[model samples]
Target chain A: MGGHELSVQPDAKLGLHKNWFNKLTSAWASGLGAVTHKELADHLGGKRLLILLGLVAVTGLSAVYVAASTIRESAMEAVETGFVFLLLFSTSGGSLPSFLSFLGFLGPLLGLALGFDSVNGEQTRGTLSRILSQPIHRDSVINGKFLAALCAVSLALVALTLLISGLGIELIGIPPSSEEILRVVCFALLTIVYVAFWLSVSIMFSIVFRQAATSALAGMATWLFFTVFATLLAGLVADAVVPLPSEPTALELMRHQRIEMALSRLSPTTLYYEATSTLLSPHTRALGPISVEQLEGAIPGPLPLSQSLLLIWPDVAGLVAATLLCFAASYVLFMRQEIRAI
Target chain B: MNQGNVVIRTRDLVKRYGSFVAVDRLNLEIYEGETFGLLGPNGAGKTTTILMLLGLTEPSEGSVQVVGLDPTRDPLGVKKVVGYLPDRVGFYEDLTGKENLLYTAALNGIPRKQAEERVNELLERVGLAEVADRKAGGYSRGMLQRLGLADALVKKPRIVILDEPTLGIDPEGVRQMLQFITQLSKEERVTVLLASHLLHQVQQVCDRVGIFVRGKIVALGCVEELSSQLFKDEPYVLEVRAQPTTEELIRNLKGITGVDAVEQAGDTLLLHCMSDARGEVAKVIYQSGTSLLHLAVRGRSLDEIYRRYFLTAEEQTHRRAG
Candidate 1:
């Protein structure tokens, strides 16, 4: 309360209001809280959100059950060094895809749905003009919305991971090691970053397109392109750029594979998949195709946590850059947009 | 006729959307503690002008000083004291009335305890105490409008701007809204700028009215002053039902110095006088031995004045084009 007090001259007309610096900073800080609270509530309580949650939950629990039953039979080495619990959480078992795969596949839709209506919906509801009339800075609204959606995604991922870990312990009759827990936590964080990138992209579209439905369509289209078509496109480009004969040298084959991998990594989905796989499965030492000559004399074991983190550091950085780029574009656009409706 | 201190002043303010000028070089001054109505038809740029004044939209040219603060440079400074209720007032349909106001208070950086107290006070003031806890979506149109008013005044702003406040309200709701607006201006002593396309909507509420047409203020003054300015030279009509409506009476009435024309119909005599010559006309009628049965002054309504102003403006444009 004391922080809220200002030495504003009661009778003063115009200029900066009393405690101008305090007001500006507080507008930024509290604007975050105000918008985040409302948006988080909307995301958590929304009917569509419930449907998405149920879909993820049903698919995730089934994957976990299958992975847990298999691990129960081979609990000895699985629980000691390797990240078996984390593997159960991230890997597909039998025919069902793992929880992480489910997130990778559907997480963008959740992010898109949360943010596609972030700006234009306010305009349609007639609240954009009203909210902007307040003492807060214009950019704070977009900032708050992005942060809130990110927070919602983080919470959902955390809850799901904890549920999977708890169920794994109950079904396998063994608790995970400290390193395994740390790796799972990192995996969860990386997933949040990946989803947040999509959220930022959706919010940018929301700002650019005044119609919520159109922005939503654009977000889904982008997600589908990255997840489903990016690999095909990357393969086609690789073939054209680095065509290799059927009996090409091993080095030439490796060069062609490198080119294709680089092209595929342009999509955020590829980056997220590579990063999460390394973090969730300690045995996953490399993301690209490796020749036997390179691994002939190498000792085969799970890499240390630091080595694993180093392996995927670039992917994590790429996800972070993409998120910031989308958010920054939206911020500049929102600032330049005229507040008045034509 | 200038009375109160000037609280808001705009000089040659212009807003252009590409080549289409939304507001064209408009100058306006609003006084403190006065309900200034911005009267216009649809697409008259009333909303655009208000947005510029609020600093929500930047002006292409000229400047605006609200409460002596340049809104363009110090929008937060202007916004801290000015309250605006857009034509379509929207609220979070999911939240209760109290929660919505509290959210706005937090956005304005009010302390939590004080915000709660203020939200309660505003909810009570707007006559929404009983339904304060209910979701706004459940509220009626009139209730939502009332909530919108409370939301605007939640911070106890020194100036209030309402656009079409009673546009979709029922007749009873319209009356209540007008009463509330009048009270807001008079009792609170807050400067009010109310924009409406309906002439009578502002007729009783605004102390001064600015008639906006086609991105410009075509006529601006106190309603009475504007009426006089528009119809100053037009003869005042006096309707009199007299006992003897004869040619002699008409001739006598016509002979009065200021009387421009006198017409007789049945038992009534219509006197078109250049000035208010009721006394002289009465004397002439008395001298003619005609007993005056009833005498009434005929004046034009604000609606008629609004129409004529537009008509004259149109003629001027036509003349210029030709």
Candidate 2:
């Protein structure tokens, strides 16, 4: 039987003799579209999205309200600054941080919640094998899922930003200038990228851990470590690297500060804070330690929007690169995985 | 079985996981529009073979051709026409059963209008129309299996592979699933490859069965052909039920030329014979002035054939080791 001659029959039903490249391209397109549509519906209609959005909305609105009231009390001083609209995001009042700070703290939680179970949940449900058996490239599953979650998060962030801007305009009685609006749009876009980085990290965790609960915990652990402990750890490392005494000279002090700054930037939370602070405060001229000699001839006015963006370009690029790296890690792991129902 | 063109062929296929050989030197062929069963015990490499056939996993050696296209090279093309129902099939619990089927239809690139109509018709065909609107989470295991069958057929695929479709279902559910598979192949003219560990269940629906043991097929043919081949050197056990059994009757039964031994238990007689001797034994019973109540031959069951092959394979391994 093994040595019997066998004839290969051409598949007439599927018309396989036509241009192979065209067939493959069309198959990939349809598969990706179908997966993206299905995952988008799942994300938008899920209760998880609703709960996370509500948490962000309530906290964000309260922070904005506090900042708005504080700005109104010092309305003349803020108006004189010529960027009262930006003040609504950067101003802090009576024990509450500004809206930008609140977003920086809470945005990762939203990302972690959306992606911590994206891959492992399907495996446990026994749906992974069924979905993969479809006529699609294996990468389409992960790509479509990431794309859908990003869309949902983008929608939530945009809506929240617009709502706060509307409330600020009504309460502070100052419409944002064109530059302020541009800065705010940049802020919104930067926030999305930061959240997307966390989303990719959580997705990577989901792929590495078999259990959904374990993956969720891993994501939260990473978030907590970066958010709370990273800065303190950086400070300890800097002190160890460049010991500073009470009687140290000015040069030594600058050296310690620079080391601390460099170490702290390794954390994504720190990067997000530095980037958003520069974008929101037009009057900000420097992000790092500067000598009196370098500042002697500098003008005492707000920097242009382009200069501010330049000051934070490295931070923005760092966030985008981190997002892509995490996504790429998860993509490689998922593709190599043996997808058996277990 | 239909003598149509061979739709699936594998030559010298093998799979290895580290040092463990999962499938070894497998050679198989399934003609178009035939229901073939890959029967084996658990861990007999049936699922591995099925995965290789579907292009879900690549073989370590040799090659596989499905519908004349190499699975490793053109998996998407093969997948376009081959529908697979995995063991313990799962659905998105949050979605309704109808929605799950529609999702599969969409993935296969069926138009929305056409997919909806086909999904509805399949839901009706699989007896899931009443609960089509309910979330799959609320469905029973049997209902899920039926929904899986409906999902596999949503694209009107030419070949369908079902791995343990009856694994966890109740007796009645298994019977219904077997009936559905048989009807599917007969009515739709679709080729079916069913991988299962349950021998009698596969025997009910499959036209040809390949008894797999230890990553190799020991027998491959129709049921009768396999039975005849395996039992050529073994004697057939003829069980006879009669009233008023006597020594003379036993003596006379053993006197038959093909009968090798005869034993009497209560009102029944067990006769081990080289060939079928039911007619001669009946004539002897009538001659002895005793009434024959029942007669049955017991070596032709698939369960027996599977057990025989398993024992032989185990003995061969032990001999080689020794």
Candidate 3:
């Protein structure tokens, strides 16, 4: 059969008769949609992702359980009971950090893990060049991956948030107010933005590094620096820049603390923590050190949701800017990169 | 320069990385419906040229057009019509062969129904229908090559650019692949741009070949023309073996008009001619006292031509440095 097929002459070559305009049909949406679907499926089904999900679920519910028990025991005012849901996510309980804290600390790692190898893995598999050779524009490949990872993070965030809310209702026997739910949703969105920043950074590393393991390590190193060392480094810089007297005046001490806080906020983890704390805890009025004089003028009441959003708007904007900058850098690098694999 | 038959044209097509120029001012015209081979050694910039042609890599300084569309300006259009098979073809390990094809088809915007039909047909065409449902990771190198070929053809591209398609395949697989490539050009009318360091592989199928050296086209023409060019003033060797003595026959053979020289070695006589002068020499041998037993012509081989051209290129480089 093989010999017979070999003897069979191929028909005359395809003529130059294809409608050139038909070739111009842009499949950007379809291509992006197809790639996103595939990647999302891979992420969701991945064993590593499952393990992370299980860990978050166990840790989150345990904290929620402890916070709910405390809220039930201290339930003296009905009007203020709705605020207990916020405490469930914001305050650490029973020797464990709050669910929001866990997310702020560990969420970026998930994003980084998902995306660190997105581009280079395809290259290593030898599919990056092939997919780029397809009819879709080069932009779609990276955009699809970013969008898919963001979608996965967003899904996990929403599911975890709802689970906490459901547990709060069951454990405390009090449903959260409409405002609390709104804040949780906004917090969920903020967490997605925070995670996406790391995703873009990881993808940039992937494009810069050929090996998947190398990119993953780089991402982990950055995450560790921001999470563990950024604050200590910020304090050192602050103290070195603004030396405190042995018996410092109030103004000097305030200046030293302000510098430390400002420098520490440079880390995405700090930004996310501040933003989520403000969003999840309405009683929290300020992110920086408050002067005693200013506290004397403040009212002993919960601020409105709008006020909380306004307070953390800069942090939200910063997270967005960082995400876009990382994404833009990766976009330019990928576009300018030579297609031939090393 | 936008002639209808000129399917692909590259003028001053140079690609540089830092100080290294991978492709230097290459000018080429590949006509429509012709299987043109870009023949060269490793690092000769054949892959870079192909990348520029596909618009996957921008040329530092040059221009390229494929199917009348500037690949740089209209890469999607060029890519739509041009199928590319990289030297190291890769597929998603977990996806089935058919799934991989379908994914490529989707990216090309082929409707799902049409993509399914086309995928099955290509799978069968590549003799991989039985294993279409198997994961690509389990496939052998030859199977993967065929799968890559099918992937390239999934969109029914007018031009197929194969970069070292037979690079790592077994000898039998190489022969089959070469045959498949020829069939693609002959039967399907797909204009093929097969780039390879293997001179013999391209020589077996290419209608025209461009030999590259140090990022420059050192030679370009059909196989016969290249051979003649390399052996320009050299004579064709014709050996005549006869059972009897040939002193008079050698003199008679020497009298032929185009015969350059004649020498006798025992029962065999060597005739050097500027061109083919076998007919006249045969008639003269019949008239001589000896009967003809065997007559053989030893023409310049492509291997010799390839070696001479590369050596000349090396010498030119050395001379310039000196």
Candidate 4:
């Protein structure tokens, strides 16, 4: 802020932020916040930040639609709330929403969308070499950019989540109690991981493709191929190619298992969302509708949230590790690539 | 400040692109408090050499040390003391000139107060104070060069390396740049390294020069010393009033001898003599029968010396082949 020539401006044109009074006023206006103000400025300076806000708007709109349409409570008030939860689990909480849909699914896509143009845009504008030539460490640029993008996607999620809460209050005519708010926060935390999952994926693509457009395309295509129609197509392909034997054998089971594993487990979205549902829901161990047969069989009670979390902790750790590994790989690649001005 | 010690030292520095050697084995040392010029024509490896020195490109062989730090192992260390302007300075087009300077200064660890004062001084010195807050995208080439020069000066680095600083500048801009460079070298005592194609480009301001050809330095020394040494008892061109035979030349001599070659124009005889013999040869011509109608002696220019002495090795190969 200091090295820019202030004499060029007639002293009046400089931003208020630099003025002492403005600093006091800015501090007053902002009051006190947990996040540093300087960090907030950097978070907003990201290139694709506006587009990411748009993504959040889409997420909020989708949440509003699902919240509005799925409230058919008056028809079956006796069991409608459970029906609603079941409907939410089956629709908004499942593979389509987590895989191809916006809330859980677009979380990772938004991460990739945040960083696909990181290095190449700088190279195109011819700042890469000059930036590297400075005294700053090479690690800072990549790390700073990723942190900025993460902040942006996180902000987007917060706004969307808040908007969803606001809409639910208006439409359902009830604000959630403190406990439900806490549950929402947990969901939001899970969504951040989901965002980080894709952010890492996008960042890895950014490092590989030195051109911005190519990197962006690679990111989008990877997201699409992994999340959309991957499992469904895998089953069809396996059925088409692997002929049914007279009797089911280990070979047939192995072929089907291989196909399902490759298509369903390969994507980060699928893995993370599956883990999220397992960890969040308390009634998952119960049958679809507990009937007399379940009572005869003596099914155990629903597990505690802690035990549920413990059961899926390995899966969560695996997915989180995969996200971080992708990010680390990108860091190494970008650090090694020549930062030429051209 | 090791008064006469070298600020930059490279040992047989070589940069290659697979089989093609962009810069061959080049060994050079630039001393402290001196304005050094790397003079070369196109495809002459000047850019490649600078890139290698700045650690922007890896060298195929040899080593580079700037201010006692290896550029490859200690690039941040080297960059801390060196301010470089690339051949075509490509700045962030979106940022204002002031923002760019501040960002760079902050990155270099300059405090806000000092960076501001230095930026003001640098902008005024480079004659770009008026457009400091304007976006650099719309700047003219000369203005951009001036801004780039100011940006480099923001750090007030000990070593300033400018590649083709005046390449696209007009005559006035070139004059301003050269004068600024000269002032910085003399007043600030900064080590200046100017890389350019035109030999005459920085001749007026430069203290010494390295003439590069085919990735090797054909010549390296102070301009004055090199000029004096090359022309020392070497050769000179003298024009006389009329063509003369051996008898007239000997008789018209004023205690002068050892004129090696003589040629005739329509009405003048050109005398090629030692650098030291100019006074005597002119006196001899005036005193004798030549009548001293027209006595003119032209010293060789550095441009001529570069063109005549440092022909690219490829040209020699071509000549031999032909």
lDDT, model 1: 0.85
Instruction: List chain B TM-scores, each candidate.
Output: 0.86, 0.95, 0.86, 0.84
Q: lDDT by residue for model 2 over B1-322, one digit each (tens)? A: 4689999999999998779888989999999999999999999899889888888888999999999988889888898989889888899999999999999998888999999999999999889999999999999999999999898898788999999999999999998999899999999999999999898889999999999988889899999999999988888999998778888889999999999998877777899998899899999999999989998997679999999999998898799989
Supply DockQ values for each candidate: 0.59, 0.56, 0.55, 0.25
lDDT of 3 by residue, B55-113 (tens): 88888997898898988899989999999999899999988999999999988889899
Best by TM-score: 2
User: lDDT of model 3 at residue A228?
Assistant: 91
Clashing pairs in 4: B254-B284
| Predicted candidate 4 versus true structure: per-residue lDDT over A96-146, tens digit per residue | 242114565566567776677677777776666666667666666676666
Top candidate on DockQ is 1
Provide interface RMSD per model, one decimal.
1.3, 1.1, 1.2, 7.8
Ranking by lDDT: 2, 3, 1, 4
Off by over 4 Å in 2: A1-28, B244-248, B286-293
TM-score of each: 0.89, 0.94, 0.88, 0.78
Per-residue lDDT tens digits of candidate 3, residues A1-342?
A: 999988976444432323333342334454776787778877887776777777778888898887777666667753453487688888676688888878878888778888899999998989998998888888888888998888888898788888888988887776778898899889989988998999999999999999999999999999999999999999999999899989999989899999999998899999999999989888888888778988996778788899999999999999999999999999999887878762
Docking class of 4: acceptable
The lDDT of each candidate is 0.85, 0.90, 0.86, 0.70
Estimate, for each residue in A1-342, the C-alpha lDDT of model 1 and write its tens digit. Answer: 555567543555344465586676676665766777777788887776677767777778898998787676677867675667676877566788777778888888878878898899888888889898887778778888887788778888788878878887888766788998898889888888888999999999999998999999999899999999999999998889879888989888888899999999999999998898888888887888888887999998899899999999999999999999989999999999988752
Better of 2 and 4 by lDDT: 2
Cα lDDT for residue A263, model 4?
A: 62
Candidate 1 runs further than 4 Å off: A1-25, A28-30, A73-81, A243-252, B237-271, B277-299, B318-322
Per-residue lDDT over B1-322 for candidate 1, one digit per residue giving the tens place of the 0 to 100 score: 3487888999999999999898988999999999999998889899999999999999999999999999889998988999889888888888888888898998888888999999998888778999999998898889888888888898789999999999788999889889989999989999999999889989999999998887888999988889899888888888888886777877777778988877776666788887888888777878888788888666566797789887887788799979
Number of backbone collisions per candidate, in order? 0, 0, 7, 1
Clashing pairs for predicted structure model 1, backbone only: none
